[model samples]
Target: MSTRAITGDQWVVLRVPISGEGVTAEVAAFAARRQLRYDLGDDGTLRITDPESARVIVTVRWKTLPPQVPRTLGFQLPSAAAVDVLIDPGPGLAAGRIAAALHDALSGRALAYTDGELEGIRAAMPLLERYSAARPAFDNWALIFRDHYLEHSTGFVLAMERAGIPAEWIFALDKGDRTWNRERVHATFQARGYRSDVLDNTAVNLPHAHGDELARVGADIDAFLDAAHTAGRRVLVVDDGGLLARGYGAIGAPRTADAALELTVSGIKRIAAAGPLAIPVLNLARSQVKSRLGYREIADSCMRRLQALLPDRKLIGRQVLLLGYGTLGSRLAAQLRGLGCRVVVVDSDLPALIDAAESGFTTYRTAGQALAATSPFIVVGTTGERALSDADLDLLPDGLVLAPFATRDFCALTENAVHRGGASDIPGVGMRFALDRGRRVTLLGNGRSMNLFEADSIPNEGYDAYRAGTFIAAASLCADPGRVPAGLHTAPADDAIAEAGLWSAYYDLYAAQGKGAVRPPTVPAPRLADLPAPVPF
Candidate 1:
């Protein structure tokens, strides 16, 4: 040996706190190939044991950065997790990318994974530490469930187990109910013309859900809230109404700041008051949270909201067709009915159509069946399914007042219809969801690939790529190489690249440590040969 240095070798332990076990193989595989000795640290830390010498240097790989830019989690050592990676102002950057890579390498299969951004309430502080005799974390980290996808759950579990993080601390409880926070089902957008169910309720209503009924609903909500308050578990509330829908309305804990998730907006003060709380209230409409100008959502929002200012002159008055009355459409239908417009909700589902009818909103099965004035009012498609037709357009003439709020083509059907039906290609406007006025806006653009039918209403498929990346990173870290707390990680791609870049800079700093101490890039991160068992210290 030509006097190998001890600077770049150690048993890297990754305490992956996820629900699945994979990506572990990748770390090991990578390490094996690079001939790096990796030891799995069971006590929530990846212990890289073998170096050329016994002298140790800690590298801080705090979570939160790097979809490209690594932002620091402000990890301090009142009892710091081991680290030497920070170059004075290290950690955080490029971390997000690392996280994404890890998640995919590990639990990519399951986990309706999306890239999360771990935003800190405090100023982007330096990684200061309160040392407690060289140990791991002093405060326990938390993990919560956001959905019931078995893949996510399994992947999370597997990742955590493989990382060798203790099981007791990582909770993985799933909300047994599916409709807990479903938006489309509970009806968030449309609020005018009635649905069949509302019609049915109105048709045979002995009385409205009130008085004693309201009391009953209130009690149930209280019970749910009480349970959450007592637990203080940092839970991931995972129902699909874009993330908030307790129809007939009874959300537990109006004071929603508990460790126990399903945390509602009600308890903001209390929740925020409880320590350094990181509230990642899922922006159901993130598909629209951006832009230089105030956010612009589907034109319909302007149409619907017009009621508050003009009250009677609401957008509902415009001729409109409410398609797919699940959660997204139902509200749109109601909103249309409010604006004094002739509204017809078309859906194959008899019950939904019936609900639409009940709500004072007319219901039709298909666009074909409900053909009124060809180019009637605004044709807003809500179902994440198909598109519109040319025949339907022929009647409406103002060239189909349209808005596509999806990643895929809502106008696909109509696009095809135009092509198939041999009519002049009259394309609909595309809505781009962006952030504006501090809230979000869906900006309607000209093209279709990046911005048509892309939801301003909710963000289901919108964040899949980023989420996928985080999952990949987390999983990779969980490998016998490295893993960090999978909690509250806000990984923006910008942050990920930043971290790597920072790492490079830090390496340079380490080399120039003054006094003529010179060195080349610290040996590259060793590759894993195979997913290995946690090597003992």
Candidate 2:
């Protein structure tokens, strides 16, 4: 749908269908990127003001449609909603394309502009494209977990569709995302002729309701697998540990995928706890491409989210304690030092502690020791396991902030906080638990990866190589499942991704000077709580 500006003497209005995702954050981020001043009100209304004069330049208004009438231009709207962008007709505002740019941003549709104008618009907001449009043949169907807001992930799914393999279904389980519209991805997929619907399992929280949500998602997957089996098409599972851990085993029905690809280290741990698998499982979690390249971006995002959460706090010259000196933790420790902070690193592994000590950081064997030695204002947790024990909770400094890169790192406080004073929510910042002796600690995120807590931390360009590598691995595995035995395999997928010349593609796209490495537009990092939440469906 092409969105045109309805012009008047004072304001120009741009109307577009809303997908019930986080539209307010998208608009606020748009304003922040352009260095434009924007304000969000309590009633879900947004106003963009002039930076110099502080006068209102634009007003974003939202309109809701009744359930009886939900179709627009023959497309089903996720929520009965639409948004109107009211812009000022002032010169130098690029008034003609502001509405169109926002329209394309909110709704992933083609803009009604000339070729030259289209090029400019693309430069303003570049979408992810397949590294190579080579249509490889694949036999099995796919069920993948993806954050639809990320364009690179969306591109990965589209690339699979372009290949012979069909996406039977896609999953979006992140309930805390606030920047991009996952529903837009859902609508875009439907519009592009893909028969996949985003299975939203976001309503399920972790720890307490983990099994409940997993069972719900597993049932859906079981049904999909059954349909695929009846159609004589074996399904390939691309899991992020959410399914393979417990839910995949709970399926009482005789439904299983032909092959599976595990994505994260946490996922690998979950799979290990779940015991050996029946089908061939490829491990992309241990791939060199991801370890050598992707972890850096992940660490960068972690720090970015931390900084966004503490915008007013100064990091320079302050002592900071970091748990786990693994791939992500090591990188985050370095980043913390680079920010001029006194970094204290803790690791259960002796070699890791020695490595941190050799790297000129204050190393400790546990969080208790680190807390006892240094009075850090911020304590970062990267260990996937429990970083702080129940006894260690007694050592927490007053008003110390805890930033968890993994979910279970600070589970001691989040999952079970035992103190005479109790815990309370800090609004945009996470929960603040009162400790004994009048000391308290604040959790930066909801006991999950801080980078993924209501924020699009990693840039599409930053993670392009890893996603492409995953695609290469998936295509190669599906083409010949016999290559990997009926067990979890890592070397085969790593070799395949390496043999596919992914590093060359990545270098050419990002590192090599004068190559087609185009830096995508910078995504604005903001506190998501301040942005408008989507209207519930």
Q: What lDDT does the true structure give each of the candidates?
A: 0.33, 0.65
Across 1-537, the per-residue lDDT of candidate 2 in tens digits comes to 445643435354555544323567777887787788878888867776678987655566665534433221112223334555444433344543454455556555321122232222222212123332444436545554534345455556655665556544433333234434345545555565544433322332254555565566567667766777788776666766655664452234255577788878877877777676777888888888889988999999998889999999999999999999999999999999999999999999999899999999998888888888789999899988888999898888798999988767888776673641377877767777887788878888677777876665676557767777777777778778887887778898888876776665556545677645643333231222332221110
- TM-score of every candidate relative to the true structure: 0.28, 0.70
The TM-score leader among the candidates is 2
- In Å, residue 514's CA in model 1 sits off its true spot by 62
lDDT for model 1 comes to: 0.33
lDDT of 1 at 234: 27
- For candidate 1, the 10 contiguous residues with the lowest summed lDDT are 123-132
Cand. 2 TM to true fold: 0.70
The weakest ten consecutive residues by lDDT in model 2 span 528-537
Clashing residue pairs in candidate 2 are: none
Per-residue accuracy of model 1 over 99-174 as CA lDDT, tens digit each = 3333333322222122121111011100100000122221222232333222222333333323333344333332
